[model samples]
Target chain A: MERVLDMTIQEVRELLRKKEISSVELTGFYLERIKKYDGSLLTYLRVTEEEALEMARDADRRIGQGEDGPLLGIPLGIKDIFCTKGIETTCASRILEGFVPPYDATVIKKLKDRSFVHLGRLNMDEFAMGSSTENSAFQTTKNPWDLSRIPGGSSGGSASAVAAGLCAAALGTDTGGSIRQPASLCGAVGMKPTYGRVSRYGLIAFASSLDQVGPLTRSVSDCAVVMNAIAGYDPMDSTSIPQPVPDYTELLGRDIKGMKIGIPREYFIEGMDEDVKRAVRESLAVFEHQGASLVDISLPHTEYAVATYYVICTAEASSNLARYDGVKYGLRIDGKDIIDMYKKTRSKGFGKEVKRRIILGTYVLSSGYYDAYYRKAGKVRTLMRRDFDEAFKACDIIVTAVSPTTAFKTGEKIDDPLTMYLSDIFTIPMNLAGLPAMSVPCGFDGSGLPIGLQIIGRPLDEGRIMQAGYVIERERAVKKIPDTLR
Target chain B: MKITKDVVEYVAHLGRLELEHDEVELYTTQLDRILDYVDALNKLDTEGIEPTSHAVPLDSVMREDEVRDSIGVDSSIRNAPERKETFFKVPPIIEVEE
Candidate 1:
């Protein structure tokens, strides 16, 4: 029965359908695991014990009434970034501490419609800023595989929660590799939907254009199942696409014969870990064995991705975060005057990284430097997008490493922001291009850390990446549960 | 490209953030390093390229000018740091004639 906590959402779905287990039992199992393991992992910022159990009881009643939704009663974790009605959503930052949203995020609404029980709000980088969870205003979420190492961020808690078996699956946001990078480091399957696929209405703003919601699950099929529930059009979100949502699970186990997989030369650059490169190359061969053709390709503008991403993201962040004045929601430090109030509140509320980014964003968007920095970066972003457009023309999917290296030790790169930023180099371009990408566990490094192979598809083409990922997932069906849990 | 103390101070002011003296010094050095790294963008020739605000080309997103129910004052003010009735309380903006 303890092994029930390790089952995927799909497996749990069948168990509920067969009446072998009630939703209450399954939810309680995960809640118990979270209670036992979460103290060391620091995966959950808040465990919605009452809400989750109450929802589970309702789910059990629905199951008894013959309800047949895939996510019915499945316990999952929500990233602190998304608004849950009456649930505190702090975006792992002090600025939003103790703030509970009055309304549910659109994603939360959709999942609730499917009767998915949320375990709690998972920890993340402060306002989804840094690469490692160390930037969290609360406790750092450690990697489930190696306790001393960091679980990647800003969705570190989501990945770690799933990997630690604390939740059946978890929801995360990826503005710049927040979902996939952490998924890779934690050895879970994570998929970032196309930018506008999932509505961001209740999501805490980080860089409006780049921010996207995704799922980190134990398997690709589970990712597809979660996507089916969360992905679609929404009138509430201005950026939500009107395209019809497909049954993401429909494309699973589809034949990949004659599919062209591109290996972007620029992504395989200098200083990338040899183990990561080797593991990714080996997975390409697995795809080739599945009758897919691998072609070497180029995204020449890849070098400019990080620089452009920083400038544009920070500029937008500055504008979006300006709404958090002294009078508004969350933290407020009163001062002698209004101006002083705003300054004091912000300076005291935001973490060091958040403040640094605000300063950088302000400088870039300021009167004197807007043209040289912001506009130029935006233009370079166009060039980077063009590189993807050209490369995608020759391939069905692009294969690359999610990050240059696996999980680094905690406090290793927290002080060096540049090196920390570079950790998401490979995953950043896909976000900038608004394409769907998935990170699937490929193999392990010498230190037994998991390496992730990134599968990138064109905009609105999550099906293709899932189809390709399904094959790799089948061939390399290695159990990656950390020894800590065992 | 050299981010000096004045530049850091001015940026912090524009960002509406108060920085202590040590923070200013620390930020100046850190920003200098990051800005120097980001200077790599200047190497590319983006002469005629149009800046892309969004990855996808979205037409003007306009909804019908119809009234809809909002969360209203109570729920909206639930998270306010300081609230009075239905309004969020804040420091006064006007300067009295002394």
Candidate 2:
């Protein structure tokens, strides 16, 4: 055995095709890894061993019958934000601690139908609120690279699981920078498709218009394979685009000669960590060497992105999360009156961060202040979009550093919420523009923590983004295994 | 841009979350700091700009008014805290005091 844990999705599929590995054996191998190593990593909240084994057996049977899909028998770690039928989808919150959704998210259904084995549900920030898994109510997931450090989140568990080789790939939901930030911190490839590219049915809403689901995998090709399976219109999700799905793998290995890649000048400013800037610059050099042109473009509204994102996202989150009152579902408390019950249940059920956002959102969206704060923020959002529109007109794709620095120590900024919020400063703009973005490992910091390069694309143009990411991910040759894991 | 403890409590009430006295003071200071940072937007020249909600251009995507089977009210409300005869139960609004 060549250590199946080190193999990529493509290699695993190749092994399965040659009968060198059965799906059952592969699933068993990963499940054993999770059982053995996940105690320290805390990557998974629930492990469906029986379900995964049964699905793997079925995949072997399907392969025997000459019907193997791209993801056939592949094990995936699912973020708990997606609803899985008859399984607990907690979104890592106490309100729904024991609640099992009666339905499956569209992505889960698609993967299940294709015979992809389910490894388990990964942990996340409560309602996908924080950038670190430290906010998860059940337990905090540590970065596999350094147990003393934090895994960037709210998709931290998904990123860590794939990085640590607990699963071949994982699914994650990104509202702002949940997927990309975590992926960058953990040395994994995470993609957030253009808005409406993937169905949102059964995904618990964080900020309705901003939330999107995508993949966190070991490689860009694996991301494309998963996207192909999950990116299609679902009648259940009204926001899903009704466009024809493209063959993402078809564009792989394409030449990038004479392609224009824009490096936004505003992104590499004074505050960026020197090491991260150097890594990104070196990655850009590789692109230029590969016959691609790098143009300097300016998104003037870049400085305003974090502020715009928080106001708009918080305003929406306040409204969207209001559905969790005691009346419908989740936790409910006995009170003297309806108002008391609502207040008590919410107070006891929600965490400090969730409560803070709700309050801020409510204040912004209130009747008297709507025009001043909420509406004004919305206007700024339009200008932010216009900035990207102008930038894209000059370049085919935009590249930037995913985070200012690599993974930090576990308790570095947990007490200071604003410091934690700055972790996604570079990534919030893409969500504001509803553009496709991806993160790939570029290099490592002095302490050996991995750094990532982010590539952003035009709206609904994920094919080109992945194609470009594939080019860099291969050429960079930055496969850094964490010291803690090794 | 200074958020007072009173403002935090008021906002908490609007959000339907109850906070303790100590938390009220703590969050008041924290939210004030965040609000001050974000208050930079007040300086932007968005005088004639229209507020944009959705990023992509979209028109009405309404569906036909055809009757289909419901998602089953029973299953939907299966997890409700208080129910009575297949309907969710909540406290009555108006009190009749004699």
Best by TM-score: 1
The alpha-carbon deviation from the true structure for residue A21 of candidate 1, after best TM-score superposition, in angstroms, is: 0.9
Models 1 onward score TM values of 0.99, 0.97
- Enumerate the candidates' DockQ scores in order: 0.86, 0.77
- The candidate that wins on DockQ is 1
Calculate each model's fnat, 2 decimals. Answer: 0.88, 0.81
| Residues A1-486, model 2: lDDT tens digits | 436666667778988988899999999988988988899999999999999999999999999888878899999999999988878788888887777787788999999998999999999999999998988989899998888888899999999999988898999999889999999999999999988899999999999889999999988888889999999888888778889899998888898888899999889877778999999999999889989999999999888788788888999999989888888777888788878888999898888889888988888888887887888888999998999999999999999999998998887888888878877888898888788999998888887888989999997788888888888888987774554554
Model 1 agreement with the true structure over B1-98: per-residue lDDT tens digits = 48999999998998999999999988998889999999999999889999999987786788899999888888989899999988988898898898
iRMS per model, in Å, is 0.9, 1.2
Which 10-residue window in model 1 chain A sums to the lowest lDDT? A1-10
Candidate 2 has a TM-score of 0.97
Cα lDDT of model 1 by residue, A78-108, tens digit: 9999999999889888888889899999999
What value of lDDT does candidate 1 attain over all alpha carbons? Answer: 0.91
TM-score of 1: 0.99
